[model samples]
Target chain A: MRKLYLAGAGNVSKNLLSLISNLNSDIKIMGIENSRGQLFSEESLSMADINNFMKSPEDYRKSLNISKMDFDIYVDMRTASKNGERERDDYINLMKNGKHIVTANKSGLANFFPEIGKASSEFDKKLYFEATVAGGLPVFSLIRSSFPSFTVDSFTGVVNLTSNFVMKKVNDGMNLEEAKRKAMEEGVAETDMTDDLDGTDSARKAVIIANSLFHKPMRLKDLKYSGIDENNIKKNEMLLAKISMNKEFSVESRVFTLNSEDPFLRLAPMGMACSIGFKERNPVYISEDMDGPLETAGAVLSDILSV
Target chain B: MRKLYLAGAGNVSKNLLSLISNLNSDIKIMGIENSRGQLFSEESLSMADINNFMKSPEDYRKSLNISKMDFDIYVDMRTASKNGERERDDYINLMKNGKHIVTANKSGLANFFPEIGKASSEFDKKLYFEATVAGGLPVFSLIRSSFPSFTVDSFTGVVNLTSNFVMKKVNDGMNLEEAKRKAMEEGVAETDMTDDLDGTDSARKAVIIANSLFHKPMRLKDLKYSGIDENNIKKNEMLLAKISMNKEFSVESRVFTLNSEDPFLRLAPMGMACSIGFKERNPVYISEDMDGPLETAGAVLSDILSV
Candidate 1:
């Protein structure tokens, strides 16, 4: 059986545990580590233990014995970091200890890809991050699995569900703050909405896409992005991220109003969609109707299985 | 390096050859077998040789030396067989000779899955048939790569583009015969449109989907399907294939009119789409704007690389 050690006891990790419990999978969760500390178990954790951990994660984090834990994969469900230093260090350390990494956290990959890539290669460990970009949309997975030897010329998508929901609500006559508050209430927006509001989240995703798909080394600082602002927001406008390769790769995330007949305009409030342009064939469009912790957990599970 | 042997020198096989020519792939086409005879080459065929074969496939089939040919993968792009006897025998022979099978022919798998399944297991060789259903839509690839442990409950789709185009044209006041002729002229309908028009094509695809996705063994005779007829086809009606798993697995293909608000109804003329219902999650919708031999060749190439 493949053993998994979750790096964070948060919503995505809890959902992943529950999801795994319902499936006839060969995966087992042997440990969970949060900021409080770490929890290790010799055998796979049962549903009752998972429930207890969910109820009081702090109490379960009493043991920080990492050297004794025998796990094959390290799952990172931690919250996004601005600088990604802590997540990068954690990933490198875990990889150095002979653990494959499956991550939903984007910041570490977006900010310090060269270091992480080098470490992963040097350690001969695989890394899967399907949930980092468009949660559960299978953007990276599709490209990796289906489009072999096909050159991706560009990618344009509405990848941020929180900002998309907020913009749609604002377009429906709600004020900016009210729209954001409604999004938060509906679990569409995170408690810390600064990244979503300032386009940093979308930019980070664009950076990852460029790095992975276009084979271009990019960083968050290389992108010039503009998020939704009350003064500049337009009716029917939503955040869009575009990554293209010409003479060089360009990544941008900006608030733009699509034409009335544009398919991106038809996406649901929580929907995420992408149009991928290939070298000589017609562009392929992919979209999902919803995005959340559950969906991200599903993506994480997919990566785990792939690992 | 992978050596691929084409079982048919048809449109899809020719397209696959050309597509591989343009890519920096590690795959090589070592031989091609047609109804006339066989063409064998010790070295990988060049683009010029591929073009020559395309011009007059019969001229290149001078040798029937299958015993001397050394290839790793066998790709089947032959026309649909009504009974699938020949294709089944060919697949078994190839697998027995230690060759992995990748096919675009649906009839063999649809009609003789048990034999093929047993041979594949006995030989311990891989079988990739992504091009058999939905062309390049990546339905099977997505399920294989992304939904590892998820239970697929049902699948509904507008899979046959020829029938869809013919029905749409007839709905616009054109007679059924003229619409079918137009479709053929547009390269959407095949010269032998019996299988496509009589719903056998859709039923075969339904059988493949049911067997592959639901893990239920099904055959074409097990399905009750109706094709597009001038007297029976209603306005805005198109062929739809539905497969469900209840007390037992059920497969059906029939002509039906989708509501105007239905997303499947909004698909382009040559588009193919499928809605996959999972056990406890939201259904995923996948669609492609176009389907043809080139797209099928793309899928075939993908399978070759995977092998």
Candidate 2:
């Protein structure tokens, strides 16, 4: 049996636990943690228990008798921005301890790819993060498994859900504040929307894709990215956004004007799409519908099974 | 070094050899065969030599000095329908002789999957056929690597290029004969187009996908499929075609009328697309551009690398 340690007790983690608890018997949840600290469970955590723990992890941190860090797989689903560095450190420690990792956390991979990647290779542990971009779409996994058979000259797509949602709403004649508010109400955008609007989220995904798909190490800070400034959208006008990598492996990510027939333009609100061009064939297009929290959980589950 | 044997010297085989000769160094071609007989090469077969041999295999078969059947992988790219059972026997013989198999041939799998699959597992050898569906689109490969991660509730797509081409041409106001003639002239349809228009090709692909993806022991004869009969179409009529798997793993493939906005209706001319719906999330749509012999070779190469 493979022991799995979860690093986040949020909705994504809960959903994954719920999925695995019912379907998969080979993998068991050994431990769980949040901002406060950690809690251990030899038996698989029940959905109600996971919910209770998510509601208040600190309450159980002091009561659980077992506190083991030894696990076969470390699943990182934490999304708190402030805990980014700590989460990275936790991942590094886990890898150093010979633990395989599956993550939906983009910050760790996009920001500390070299260190995490180095540790993973040095320890010879499997590291999977298909959920980092295009939640549950299998974009990254598809490239990793298929690119060996063909020559990919470049790739382009809409990897950001929040910006796409907001931009789509704006295109439908909604005001900036109204669109953002609607997105937030629909759980499409986080309360702190700077990351999405400022293009940080998309840039992080681009960096991860570059590193994983093209084997190019790109930093989010060094990437040239422009986000949708809702102020720029005129009333009832259309807006288009896309992220692309050129033949030189140079990355370009921004919102721009494009014809409706463009493959990138077909992306729906909160949907992610990618077009990979090969040397002698027409481009391969893959896209997923609106990515919700449950979808992110689905991606996380996909990684867990893959690892 | 891994030795790879070619069982056919068709255009697809030639393209794979070209790709492997240029990109991959781990796999080296040791022998090749055509309809006449087999030829051996001490070194990798050059593109010019391959072309010349393809033009007149009997001449090369008579002149080649070295001949050997011992190889690590047997690449079957032969498309002769009359050689179907013979090819199946060859595959079983090769597997029994401890050789892995990679094939672009559909008749063998669509007809003799049980025996081949049993032989492969019994001998502990790999048998890969990623090129069997959607040309070089990696459809089967993607499903193999990723579907195990999630619950694939159902799948639907256009898996036949010839039928898609014929239908698109028919929709473009061409008569049945004109459409078929144009498809054949473009090499999109086989000269004997019965397999494609009669839905045998698509049904074969469906059997392969069902057997491979869902682990269902399905046969071609058990499947109900309908192909495009140009006589059934009226001028300026919109025709929508798709291959879909239901929740019970039963497959439904036919041409019907769909809304203009349906993703199933958005297929390009000679392009193949599939939408796979999971248990909880939206469907994942993957499509490839117009497939030619070169693309089929790309798929075969993908299998070679994977094996």
Model 1 residue B200 lDDT? 87
On residues B57-163, what C-alpha lDDT tens digit does candidate 1 reach at each position? 77864664453478899888887777998778888988888999999999899898768878898999998999988887788888878776567888998889888
Off by over 4 Å in 1: A22-28, A41-56, A59-70, A173-178, A231-233, A246-248, B21-26, B41-69, B172-178, B231-236, B246-249
TM-scores of all predicted structures: 0.90, 0.85
lDDT of 2 at B185: 91
lDDT of 2 at A264: 57
Per-residue CA lDDT of candidate 2, range A133-154, in tens?
7776777667656656565667
Evaluate model 2 with DockQ and give the value: 0.48
What local lDDT does model 1 show for residue B285? 77
DockQ list for all candidates:
0.49, 0.48
**TM-score top scorer:** 1
Supply every candidate's count of residue pairs whose N, Cα or C atoms clash at under 3 angstroms. Answer: 0, 0
